[model samples]
Target chain A: MIQFHNVTYTYNFNTDTCKDAIKNINLKILPGEFLAIIGQTGSGKSTLVEHMNGLKKPTVGEVFVSGQDIWQKKFDITKVRFKVGLVFQYPEHQMFEQDVFSEIAFGLRNNGIAETKIESLIFEALDFVGLPHDILNSSPFDFSGGQKRKIAIASTIAMQPDVIILDEPTAGLDPYSSELLLKKFKDYNKNKGKTVILVSHSMEEVVRFADRVIVMHNGEIKMEGEPRKIFTKVEELNEMGLDVPQILKVFLELRKLGFPARADIYTVEEAKQEFFRLKNLTKGGKSFVK
Target chain B: MLNNMMVGQFFAADSIIHKLDPRIKLLLTFVYTLLMFFIESMFIFTFNILAIIMVYKLARVPLKILIKSIKRMLPILLISAGINIFLIQGETVFKFLGINITKQGLCMVSTMIVRIICLISGMLLLLYTTSPAELVAAIEKILKPLKIFKVSPEEIAIMFSIALHFVPVLLLEAERIMNAQRARGAKFDSKHLKEKLKAYITIVIPLLISTSNRANDLAIAMESRCYHGGENRTRFKILHYSAYDLYALLISLLYVLLLLIFNKLDFFKIVM
Candidate 1:
């Protein structure tokens, strides 16, 4: 588990006008959990998670990852970074290689992995992201936006990090690209049992992929619970300048309109099943199968 | 990061000074700077100060901003003043322990200090009022004749604009890299100059690499956007001169005349 105990961080502390980015707080994230952190910009969500990878340290408190003090003097941060791979927003911007193959291999090479095994690992990472070998030799700059995002994620995955943290991975992507990315993330979580921490503001995306939801506002955790539980309170989330998944909003509307529908439905499929069951009951045993 | 800092140096304003034709302003700045060197009298200094006040007023620039400009020059100003007070040979003021302060030396020192202040103030006024992009365009226009020598004005313009734009970006990046290094146990102030230099080198290497990448990315992005050169390019905001500009030129000329009168009045002696 990754834990934050009474952590507080103020950026630009040496200057007179330092800003408190994260307040004192305590939280624990269990292993293998697909956790989604939702917040507006400068809400301390990014600051809190950076501590997990030793990218940032708390000004007052301590951060422990996998029961080890990350801020310890002898702790090899490169190793810590390997354990928790962070893919920042617009990950494609970080790509500097001439081709996709070399781009993915860059991280593994940095980690002192064997040269012979690098090709196999690169291919595996590419396959995991569903990119073909033909494109591997091509310039990353020549690829489409969605393809670039895939290649970026593939590069991070090649390092075989135990925990993958992505910040707005699907931002600016088209509907199809977003769906593809979400599916890949879900696949990685299910098949590899990797701990996934996704930082996003997309309610639909979070509700679809996250098992646990973390809500942040003004440098503090506003709420934290299961997706169903957190998303059910449409009013509270709305008041906090956040929105719920469209399906959840629809369910809430249905409930308001006197329909006996569940308010916690996050996906379209779940809402569809509830609607179908309700229709059948109202039809008095008449099966209206479409 | 240094580039980013320079970018922020070109403050933006929408006053009369900002609205002046950049080409005219550039030429006027040079003329004004040259005239300051010619003026070796207290009356000329008074005239210069009046001109500064008038420009500041017309620009609607705050006194606080003017004070800020002065504050930035304080260290150099004080240094020059100190050197004149102690190091230079002059008529003795008090004969402090075999030291002499000559009357001629004191006069020379004060005039030099005034000239420096005037030069600094003039440059600050120019930069404070003009946007960096407009200054780039102005410089490009002035250097347009150099195109006959196979010099690409467009390329130079792009370089100027890019440099201006990236100053803040680089400064922010430096701060980020420095913070990252600090978090990794890199001490910038460990009472050892070599260790401090090493810390700075670590910061500089990454900064240089990232800047290179940014430059490459910017080139690609610009190319993709069909930025061939300034040859066929038309400005989105074309500058024009108004009555205010004519009046400003007239005032500047009058100020120079007053400076000449001051030299004749013997308020201060001409150095050359």
Candidate 2:
């Protein structure tokens, strides 16, 4: 479990230009849950999420990963990092390695895993991300942006962290690559039972991957609930500079158009099922407007 | 951080120095430094100055950059000159207020100043033309034979690469911290030593905080890739030398040989 108890981070703490990035907000994530954190730019999403793995210690509060306080001197911070794998936005900017195999092996080497284990782990990670083993020796820089994205995620997966946090993982990818990455992440989460947390700007991604949606506004959580529940309040999300999923928006507009449709759909699959049911109901020729 | 740091720093131009192997460059600087320490006459110093000019031109570094580098070392230059001019035991020309001005002392100070400037500019010219990435590439290649000794070149390359990558980030953080302190009414421009000291201290503390945070994030990013230090790793883009590189190396050798020959025979010391 990961917990943030009244965590607040003030950048430039000693200087006059010090500004609060995150206010006193308490948050908790249970084991094996996929949570999506959504907020406007500069809403403290990055700062708040970085604290999950002891990347940033709170200035005023505490962050606990598992049962131990991350800041305690007795606990190894590096060990904390091994459990929480974070893939930064534009992670490709840090890719200085020659090929995919070495790139994926970077984390394992840091953990001091045996060379024999490292090779197998690298291949397994590449396979898990749908990249071929033959591409191991290929330069990461030569790959397409989407392929590089997969390699980056595979790099993190090779660490075998229990909790994986991705920051704007699909910021600039085609819809096809984006869907591919999301599907791979879902498969990883389900098959490995690893906790996945994503910070994204896309409402559709949040609706798709997130089991719980966390809406942050002005360094505080405006709302937190299941996607279906939180997204139903379209007005609240709009006020926070966020949007509900397109399907949910369409149903809300349908209600405004005097249709008896409920606006609870958060996915295309769910929307398709609901649309078929509505079509069948109307097919009975019962259009008596009382 | 200071964004302007990237204006021309660490860019590899097609200059002669950029083509020289890093090991050779390192050797050149070491030789230059040693020569500067042993050489005393103005004529030898003049030879050093000419060598400096040759490098400055060959590296394609602007004269203004050499001047800027010298400017930062002005305080040390002045202090060394002041001590030499006042304390050295020599033939005194005049004495004013118990201060003696000697003929040899003045000459010594001049030689010292010129030697120091020449030494610094020669090294700075090397850095100005060689990109950090290219330098690391060269270093990794040079260290490749270490694999016979069971050493890892990839680990060394990664260390240098990470250090180079953070240079810009560190400078940017410093700029932000300075601006933040300025916004808080910290008088960085104050002439008072104490106030300036306080302002600098304020700037450094926050910059340190940001650096550590960046370090943490960078560590995690590095670890995820299974970066075991220097073990059985291959490179992506291997560096190679062309005919131009060989030509540049030949010219540098000829220049150094000319300097060495003149110094060995003592043909130019009379000009001092």
Candidate 3:
């Protein structure tokens, strides 16, 4: 679990160019939950998540991980990083080892895991990311973009951290690959009961998978609730330069046209079910379909 | 740690120096360096320092920022001055722990320090006043005559601009890679040299790959846009010499004339 108390981060602090990246942020992430943070670019989303793992020190307040203030004088930040893993955006760019196996083992080796145990963890992570065993000896650069991304994720997961924070892992990936990657994280959250925090711009992805959503704008948390509750405020989201899921937008439009369609439907399956129920009602005689 | 570098960073200000043509500024900087080397008397050095201070004030650059920029060069200044203080052979004025401190050495050290400071400040003044884009355009215009030897000025200018543009960006990428490695428990603050070097390898290899990958992508994007080696190309903003540039050139000439005159009048020389 992580908690932020009155945290504020200012970039270029003590300089003329200093500007607040995040201001007075108070947040708590419970154990074993999938939380998504959605925001427009430069909305302090990245700055907020960087503090969770002690990668960035807050300018004003404290970040407590598991009831320990991370910035305490005696506390070791490296140990905190091992407990809270952060997979940055385009993590594949961080790959450096000669081969996939060593690349995946990089974090484990850094954590001082025994040589005998690193192999098993590497293979387990590769299996979780759906990478083939034969490619272990191949160089990571020899793989395609999607496979490289998988290798990067496998590298992070091999460390077996308690909390996993991903900053826009799905960016620049094909839709199918994006969905597959998110599904893996979902399984990691559900089966392993690990805390998963995803920073993303995709509303559909967030609505489909996240249990709770936090919307950020102008360095402040503007809204926080379940995806269904958050997506209902379409106008406010638009004003913040964000969008709701496409299916929810369609349903909202349908409701605006005097149909009985629910404006809260987000996923395609829910939208389809709502349309079918409306069609049945229309077939009965009291219909607003026209 | 890497953010302290002031290389190639432009400070924006609304002043005559900022508005002067980049070509003129570049030429004036060259002339200033040449004139600095020609000084052999303390009077000329003092006059040069005063001129730099006056120009710095006219440019409206913050005093603190200028001092901060100079602070980075302090170690080099100290090392060179220390070497000159004891090494120069001249009249011995004193002795410290078996080392002879010479009067001539002290004079040489002060003169060298002033010259170096004046040179650095003059170059920084040029960078602080001109934007990178304007500098590139000015270079292209100045190098236009090199086309006769099968050289392409536009290509050279584009390369210079791209290199300048990516310095800060690549620095940011390097920082990002460093943070990612740190998240994996790589300890960069380790005191052992070998461990520190190993930690840096994680950052270096990834940064190199990403740099090449970015270069490849940029090349493809440029090619797709039908870039054909800058042949028959037109510029969006053409470089032009204005009255400000002329005035700047005149002032620099005047400074050089004063320096030449001071070189002959050694009446206020420091006795060596």
Write down the C-alpha DockQ for each prediction.
0.10, 0.02, 0.84
Candidate 2: residue B52 Cα off by (Å):
33
- Across A149-234, the per-residue lDDT of candidate 1 in tens digits comes to 88988888888888888889889888887888788878888898989999998998888899999999889999999887898777
Model 1 CAPRI quality: incorrect
Best-to-worst order by DockQ is: 3, 1, 2
Best model per TM-score: 3
lDDT of 3 by residue, B1-272 (tens): 56877453788989988889999998898988998898888777877778788888999987666778788898999999998899988788999789999998999998898889888888989888899999999888889899999899889999999999999999899899999999888879988999899999999999998888899999999999998666678888888889988888887898798788768676666655
- Candidate with better lDDT, 1 vs 2: 1
| Per-residue C-alpha lDDT of model 1 across residues B15-98, encoded as one tens digit per residue | 878788877788788998998888777656866787788877877766566666677678888888767767777556666556
Here, model 3's chain A TM-score works out at 0.97
User: Worst lDDT window (10 residues) for model 3 chain A?
Assistant: A281-290
Worst 10 residues of 3 chain B by lDDT: B1-10
lDDT for A101 in candidate 1 is: 81
Stretches of model 2 off by over 4 angstroms after superposition: A284-290, B1-272
Per-candidate count of clashing residue pairs (backbone under 3 Å): 11, 15, 0
lDDT for each of the candidates? 0.78, 0.77, 0.89
Q: Candidate 1: list runs displaced more than 4 Å.
A: A8-19, A41-44, A54-62, A67-76, A172-177, A285-290, B1-4, B7-28, B32-125, B129-272
Q: Is candidate 1 or candidate 3 better by DockQ?
A: 3
